[model samples]
Target: MRRPDVLVVGAGGSGAALAARLSEDPGRTVLVLEAGPVPRFPPGFPAELRDARLVPGAWPDAPTVRAYPVRLTPDLPYTAVRGRVLGGSTTVNGGYFIRARREDFDRWSARAGDARWAYERVLPFLRVLETDLDFGATPVHGGHGPVPVGRTGLGHPAVEAFRAAARELGHPDEPDKNAQGVPGVGPVPTNSAGGERINTGTAYLLGALGRPNLTVLGDCSVRSVAVERGRATGVVADRNGRRTVLEAGEIVLCAGSFASPHLLHLSGIGPAKVLTRAGVPVVEDLPAVGAALSDHPQVVLEWTPRRPVAEPAGSWLGGALHLSSSGGDHPGDLEILQSLVPMAGLVGRRTAVPGRPLALLASVQTPRTSGRLRTVSADPRVPPRIDYGYLETADDRRRLREAVRAAAALLSTSAFGEVSAGVVEPASLDDDGLLDRWIRSRLGTSQHTCGTVPMGRAGDPSAAVDGHGRVYGVSGLRVADTSILPAAPLRGPAATAVLIGELIAHAMCTVR
Candidate 1:
């Protein structure tokens, strides 16, 4: 087996970004192995599918080329979506691009004992990888970068109404959410340029494809990380029914939250009980490999507009509202995102009759409940058990209730009243209990799954990866995707994942 300088598992957002950065040296050989093919936005796919692919479900839940239907459990009424394509979830996520809140990083640093992860320290990496469209003599943004960033156009009428409603609710206009540390209602910054998705693969991998040192293998599923004597040497992958061993000096797992930890367990790196129960040998008794899983659980607050102010069009809305919980001083707990999309089914199902369009959207930033992903079978092909313990805490329920109230208040404002019919979520706004019931029934995931392989101090038993992203108790192995996030940051995880790739590339270059 020929060894490359680096072998990246899961050529998603993080892997693509890392590959692009490492290829810049022209001397280091980087091999990216993807379990799925490169995603091409075919014209035949439904508009809803395209939009949902951008928002959620970019990662295929099944191990096939076709997109499969996702089923939601009782606890999590919303669909669980993931991308199986080369670009990963970024290819299918809503392009809403917002940086992680300073408070989020501060909390992570305090909890993980890594002061270098402070907001100020991470900003340089964020700026380097981003190309802010709203940049011009602004110190807060970078204009000349690979990743394009821009705002949605001001053509939508709902955008105006949303902004007016925010102002009416005492929220100031924040021109740029990516600026230093401000949060308010403004145009959503997206990764879309020229009305098309600019995913990580497009921005990173595509640009580096000409490099001779970088080898990209799509449609190849990595079965397990090949670990010998507590060190990762390469991976065992299945490509077109043929098994092959791809050797590398270092192995980095960028397979998102669920898959990364599952792969670790498959390679004998998880809890002894879990590995033993699955009839697999336990190379390490790391109980925290698949623990500390967290995601943003949201509750939909639907409302119908009275006068047709340009009826709801696409799931992608131009404007949004960022509100903090009533009790919390920092803007991290809960948020209210207003979208111009009707909610009828798992995917936005629209009716032909043009009576009035419904707008249903919610943001649940602070979640009290956490879940774990455990392998049901020792077979690498079997899917892991996913239990999203939604609304399991009084705090989660309270925050959700508050989020609904906030959404309702925004709709009731004078701005929305001009074109809004009435409330649709709580049917009867007077009763809080009724609203709570509606919340529990209609709540779903925001598709931001993270925190499975948390990064913390070396002595921390729960920490799967170290501050530098190297997997603990294993050499030449690291987890560089959302799985390394100690917690889901305030903003979307895609951009942060890109930053993680850049950080990892720099770390690897320094060590080499």
Candidate 2:
């Protein structure tokens, strides 16, 4: 077994970014273990995966798509979608390149008691992760970086109408959604340029393929961390039916929310009860390893267009509207995204359309309900039991109801009179009780899972890692993905996940 300077698990967005930045030293050996096949570089990736124009599931959910069964309620169960490929979900996601709002960072800073996680402190890392084509030269945006970001052009009349409808409802038109302050209804910056998805693998890994110091092993499934004498050692992985123990001086978990926590528990570093139930020897009694799973549960509304819409064959999500569900001080709490392609299936909406269809997806920005992921068995073959516990709180339900109504209002505006014929789904919008029921039955995750191994204050019992991403009771082990987010970011997690990799890579280099 050869020990590398750094072993990064999961060669997705953050994992790829971390590996690329760490390998920059040329002196340090960086090994990336990806559980999925190595995807082709941009312009060469599969048409289904590389096309930025459609929502996920444009292609049939492949074997690489890990659909975890999630218990949304006691009686209801749904599948949470995640990509098991090199680029992770970024390959399949809509490529909405939104940044974490100022409030999200401020709240994290206050809760984690680490000012370094504040908005201003993290801005540089965010800037270093993207090449913002729209707001490149701005004070808040970045010019040259790995991920290529560009404004999703509003070629479709329905999409343009949706943005105008938002503004008609008093929401100002924001030119760049990824810029500072609250986002308004306008063009969203996406991680795609020239109709190709630019995931971390495309941006960070492909260019660094020639680096001798970096070794990326695709189709390698890591079974567990190799902990020795209360310290991190390496990992045991199964590659093509062959088991191998790869030693590492340091292990960084970039396996996202579900896998990162599952990896920790498999390594005997989770709740004692969970470990005992799973028949694994308890190495560390970290209660927070698989707890506090959070995500933005969304309700989608589909509308039939009276006329034809000329849309490009790229991203469906071109523009969005961010406003308050409660109409309170927090205006960035609800998000309504406009999609030229049909996205009703994502939220359990099924109806035969009379004409061309468009989508408006409304989601609670910050959810109050939290869930957990428990190891079903010691065998990695058994997927972890995940309970999103969505809409469990009164506030969440109330906000979702408000968001649904807001979506309806946006479509009703005169701005959409030419494109939109009528709202086609959600039969219970008029009645409060029926609308709540409809939302509960149809709500789905935005695929932005986070906080399964949340970072918090050092002494906090729920804190799995410190603000610096160091595991509390473990040495030489860290987490640098959405898993370490104390809560869901204000928007999507892809860009933030890449930023986290940059921050962690910088910290690792500075320390050694």
TM-score of each: 0.91, 0.95
Flag regions of model 2 displaced more than 4 Å: 57-60, 327-329, 344-356, 367-369
How close to the true structure is residue 463 of candidate 1, measured as C-alpha lDDT? Answer: 86
Q: Write the per-residue lDDT of candidate 1 for residues 380-494, one digit (tens) a residue.
A: 8777777667677776777778777878888889897876777765776667678667777776777777888888888788788876789889999999998888778877677
lDDT at residue 512 of model 1 (Cα atoms):
47
Clashes of 1: 14
Candidate 2 Cα lDDT to native: 0.82
Q: What is the lDDT of residue 323 in candidate 2?
A: 83
How far does residue 10 in candidate 1 sit from its true spot (Å)?
1.3
Against the reference, the lDDT scores of all candidates come to 0.73, 0.82
